[model samples]
Target: MSEIATFAVGSLFPELIDKEADLNDWATEVERTLDLIPSVSRIEIDPPRGFMSFNLGDATEFKDLIQHAIPIGGEIRFHILIPARIQERIKGWSVSAGNSVEEFLVTIDLSTTYPCAFIIPLGEGVLRPSGAVIVVREFLTEELDKLGSKAAIKLTTLGPSPFHAEFHIKEGDVGEILAPGIRVSRAISSGYSRWTLHYDPEVHESAEAARTVIIQRLGYEFSTFYRIVAHRNIHRFGVAAIEAWVEGTLAFYGGKGLKSWIYRTAKLRKILHDISLEILKVQLGIEKVHKQNERLIEKARDRNSKLALEKELAEKAELGFRDELSSYAEMVGVLESRHSNTTQRLTSFAVSLLGVVVGALLTAALRK
Candidate 1:
């Protein structure tokens, strides 16, 4: 019996706060930073609508950090490629550990927008002879973090919330499964879990049965990451708005006068706009996840796998975008009403002051 095992870890790329820069600029910066690695040899930047692939140079210096269960050969030169717009345009990329010692290659799919992710595939050599998968995952994560610090790119150590990894096992006895071909673990507190796909090599040579499932699940992972990021942004803006509202109300009662109120009100308005954008982002994110989950259900290899996906989708549905939207809308409505009421009061006060001035003028004229 022969078993082929390979895995890849995915994480969200932090939102680059530079508003003025376009996609090209961001990609270029990533390219420049990654090039700083001594082991990275040739790099290709994706065209206006394409991908980048490059061969990994000799990384023997860091070989000691990885506890390999089986000895590896060659200098660990791996090729990496990303598919453009994976769901809509591409079928998905095959990322095997490599055929021979000298010909390792991996295809990583990345999104260009929020919830953008980076996947790093591990060679078969790294996971052979029953290696500790978690330890190797941690090893890669640590090295990525160090690379980020060394290159000034913010690649994740633990990755963003809802990080996902997938294992493809072509041979070997796949432990107990809830389905014919897959076993999905429930996400933990950190939103981390590894889903395994076991394929009978005889039925589908090269494990082609898992391709559609892979694309759909990867799509789900990306959407989940996006949703989390958007949700977090909403919280960030909501907190800012709350602080502004509280400060403004307290300042007015504490005799801080109109200046403080005006400043706080302006700040609150800006925060409200930010909150609105985040709300929209989350809405879009949820839609994507919903669609991908449906696709996963359709392509599920077995009854239990479909049921598991459905259950997961149902749990995700409990998050309820509608409720979130309503809550955010209510918060905005309350703030807007307060602003309107304050403006009306200010206008009335101004009119009353004008009346006092008119009365004084009339009295002075009469005296004259």
Candidate 2:
């Protein structure tokens, strides 16, 4: 195992940070330093043929949402130096860096704007498969003692586990550092390790070098998280739309219910149309962000870095994205087919109703 020079521990917040007040409330000093991270708009990825664009609706509506057609997040927004009480307990915390010792930087930054997470330095350790996890556990245990359960939970939503960790190694092949052990792979599945390796000292000097990678990594995480939530959202809407169509179709079979049937069917059609459009818009936005990630993969410093990134992207990213998109597309197709069948039924109902009304009117006039 190689000795880690320095490392950082952080967690991901499942929710997107999009409130204007939260965005505007960033500490100026922290914001100035973080302004170095790239903007989502400046990064662009050309969609392949047939990936036609759709309207993102009004700016006001999508401005703070992911549906705004841009990939935003991956920067620090708020931070505070270590508190005196906590500092006293862990003041001299250090971990071995081969023959030497490296002091920990124990400040906490509540990264709020994009890629929302809590970040702190975890000092140095032997870069093993579970090295980061072990260090973070000890660190959090001590922190929980100092901060107290209520306060710690209130300040940040950090749990017993972190979403991911960044291991900074001064030497060794990054690919190997990132590789999962046989036992760990069997336990958690292969090709998906939560810790990542990036060049050290350099990352400390200016995180700019690792910006693309960091953004893309967070992008992949957030997108994957989003896909699950999106599936639920689409599924909920699809089910409701289908229910409406079914109810409307049944109403048509009831006598003296022509107007009610027409109204319900029209409403169902509108709901189906709206949900289908929403699915497409989300798909478009996700594709654009993922394309940017593809470009970022090529920016890796060496062949090893590139290979590591490509492996991660292939194993955990691209397919996941396509799977989510394909699922959404399938839902759309099913809904569209239901809509077509419902329309044909509505047409038949309308024609038969017209015939019945006309015959009754003619019969009444002859009797008069």
Best-fitting candidate, measured by lDDT? 1
Say which candidate scores most in TM-score: 2
Judge candidate 1 at residue 306 and give its lDDT: 35
Tens-digit lDDT track for model 1 on 1-368? 43355444443232223434464455566566656644343555442343232111222233211111111111112243232222122112222422212122322234322223323233344332111222323333344466754543443322332234344455433644443454434433333345555654454456444533544454444444443333333333434444454445445434566887777555655655665675565566556645654554444423334343444445543435556475656766676677678778878998999999999999999999
After TM-score superposition, the amount by which residue 127's alpha carbon in candidate 1 deviates from its true location, in angstroms, is 8.5
All candidates' lDDT scores?
0.42, 0.38
Candidate 2 accuracy as lDDT: 0.38
Residue-pair clashes per candidate: 0, 2
- Listed in order, each prediction's TM-score against the native is 0.42, 0.44
Model 2's number of clashes is 2
TM-score of 2: 0.44
In candidate 1, which residue pairs clash? none
- Per-residue CA lDDT of candidate 2, range 104-208, in tens? 222232221223232334333333322333343344444434543222121222222233333343332243333221000112234324443443443334333
